[model samples]
Target chain A: MSMPALLDLYRVQARMAVQQQLQYRMRNAMVLVGFLTEPVVYLAVWTAVAKENGGSVGGWTSGTLAAYFIVWTLVRSMNVVFTPYGFEWRIRTGQMSASLLRPRHPVHYDLAYFAGSKVVWFVMWLPIAAALALLFRPTLRPEAVEVLVFVVAIVGAYLIRSLLQWLIGMVTFWTTRVGALFEIYMVAELMLSGRLVPMSLMPSWVRDVAGWLPFKWTFGFPIEVLVGDLGTRALLLGLATQAAWIAATAGLLALAWRGAVRRYSAVGN
Target chain B: MRALRLIALHLRVVAMYEMQYRMNFFLQLFQSALATGTGLVVLALVYAQVDELRGWSRPELLVVLGVFTIIGGVLESVVKPNLVRFMEEVADGRLDFVLAKPVDAQLLISIRAVRFWQAVDVLVGAVVLGVGASRLTPRPGALAVLGFAAGLLFAVVILYSFLLILATSAFWFVRVDSFVETFDGVFQAGRWPIGIYPGWLRTGLTVVVPVGFAVTVPAELLTDRSGWVTLAAEAALAAALAGLARLCWRLGLRRYGGASA
Candidate 1:
């Protein structure tokens, strides 16, 4: 597709998603609030630990930890994507066969739809963020360059996570019993992606491992861009890393997609 | 007595059905272990920073994790599957068939399904609790063991009632999976001692959601940090919530308009 056509396709799909999701404001609000618990729980635990350690642990003070987690809620909202579990249903129910008929790849639909919903979630996130700021009193002040980098990084984070999870989801083309595999993936992500805690608290080896993996780019790096003290060199390097991950995952996904579509057999027809 | 038999019969059928998928047992076990491992790593990180959290030592906090896992197991294996289906039935108006059953409607809905393999966490949690207890200066005495058992039972009741109340709201809204999702998120907070939370959150976990009561109180009882008075209060709270849940179910049923006419 031409660039203009692809942009138009995204625009249409995103608009559709926004319209559909706005019908369920209450439901969306509940889910948004649900997303708050994980970060809030992590924040409280780390803050307590920071306090007990006499004002700092792994260089994150309580106030800065507050900033990290509060920003965490926003980054989390941004990174939501089509779950791999949905693949089981799609393939088993012949939904994948229908998607295969489309001129454009099915991933575009998911990318656009979720991207549109982020607008709603971001709007919903504001009041909650304001309320959290009041309660936690995060010491978050970002430079203009850092703020600009963060905006770009969050979008990068979304693409990296989406492409990677989509690649994992494609494994359903071979076997339906992918639950255990998905669980293992999630566990690794939770550990390495800075979902549970900052990577700083992790041992040096884990940090080294995370640096090699794409997990930290999707979560820790983006949050740190706004909240942590990253030097100019590190900031630019992190963005480059995110771009590299996006390209790598997208390439792998393209390779996997061809094999998956060939392996697919429609169930009812 | 009849309800007990009905529950046992339903569980047997579910067990037989699940037995056909034997590999899922190992898969479930592997997933549960991974989750437990992640939790233990979090504990290690926390303890790496401090010796205790709000006076609860590392070993004591391990007990809290065990209780959280066990309660989580019960919720996932039994309570959640049934209530989620109940919500869908309410939404689609298929609940009339349930109402037509001879047994008590509430009991019927609550015991209709169970994930036999998911119950692995109960055993896993017991082993973890035992390990945590073994590390103590002195093992929990018989009295403490009894108190823990009693507290855990009451905790289950409180948790069941809390979910039941949420499920019952489907009668009014016609769908409440969002609330269930929120509950799942909130329940994760119980993995730590409630004392560590800020005052408002602590109250929310205790009063609004009851996860603190469902996980922490039992853990505290086992560790001897709570006494009979706490257990008594827990029992009273469970009974009151059970009563409230029953009332909500009755009220919700009256509002239900079946699809079939």
Candidate 2:
């Protein structure tokens, strides 16, 4: 497909996904409300713990902790990958055949849906985030350069997360129990991603190990830019790491897709 | 006697079905252990900052973690499979067959399917509870043990009832799949002592979702923070919610009309 033509096709797919999600407005609202409770849970715990510790524990006053978790929640909403969970079901039900018949690569169509849904969710998330900001009063002030880095990091992180999830979804072609495999990955992400706990506050061993992992780049690096005074060097380094991971994963995905197609063709459609 | 026989039959069928997936069994073991480990590590990190979290020492907090696992595991293993089956049946127009069955629909739906692999988590929880209980300098007495048992039973009832309420939403909505995920987000709060949260959030967790009653209050029973009044309150709330959930289920069923009418 030509570049402009391919872009137009993706645009149509994105529009379809957005319209489909809009049909379930009530469900989307309920889920948004439910998700809002999570940040409050974290805020409540950290606030109380900080109070008991004479207004600061592990170098975090309540305000700093609030800012970190609130931003973390927003970033989480942006980075969530839904297509991977659906990929297995799609392949099993013969839906992948239709995608395979498409002119452009299947990943573009899926990416369109993914990005489109994230846009819708980001809009839905705004009001809840505003209310949390008022209630928790998080202290988030970003410099101009840091803001630029933060935007780039969020984009890079989302791509990395989605690609890794797509790769994980390939396991569905081999086994029906993709959920079990995903759960193991999720536990690793939860512990390492700095979503469950601030990386600074984690035990030394955990922090050291998390430093070496890509999960933090997907979840933690952007928030760290806003929440901490990470210098230009570290910011650039994190962005570079994200780019490297994204490139590596995309290449792997292409190889995996070729192998999957060959295997599927050999099995008769 | 008939119910016991029915439950045993269901358990056996589940075991047989799950026995085919030995790979899944190993995956479940790894995943469940990883989950438990993550909780323990988080607790360790929290204690590294503060000696005690809201008057519960590290050992007592481990009891909370254990209760969280047991309740979550039982819900996933026993309650959730049935709930998922019920929702799918409703969606796929199979509820008519289910309704036409001679057995009571509520009882049938409640115990229809089980994922036996999650029983591994129950064992893990029991081991964690035993270790957590033993690690305390002064062990809990017989009364404390009795209270833990009562509280744990109430927690299971409350959790099951909550699942019923959520599952019953399928009667009105075309898709209510993420309700379980939302419930999970709320339930994660129970992994820690509810006492550590602020009053409003503590109240929200207690009344809105009842994670406090489900896990923390049970943990408190073992830790000696739960008084007789708290235990009584929890019992009353569980019975009330269970009643409410049954009423919700019946109303939803009436509206559903066996997915055919």
Q: Which predicted model would earn the best TM-score?
A: 1
Local distance difference test values of all predictions, in order: 0.91, 0.82
TM-score, prediction 1:
0.98
Question: Which DockQ value does candidate 2 get?
Answer: 0.53
Residue B76 local lDDT, model 1: 97
Question: What is the TM-score (0 to 1) of candidate 2?
Answer: 0.93
TM-score of each: 0.98, 0.93
RMSD of 1: 1.1
Clashing pairs in 1: none
Candidate 1 deviant stretches above 4 angstroms: none
TM-score of chain A of 1: 0.98
DockQ values, each candidate: 0.87, 0.53
Q: Write out the backbone clash pairs for model 2.
A: none
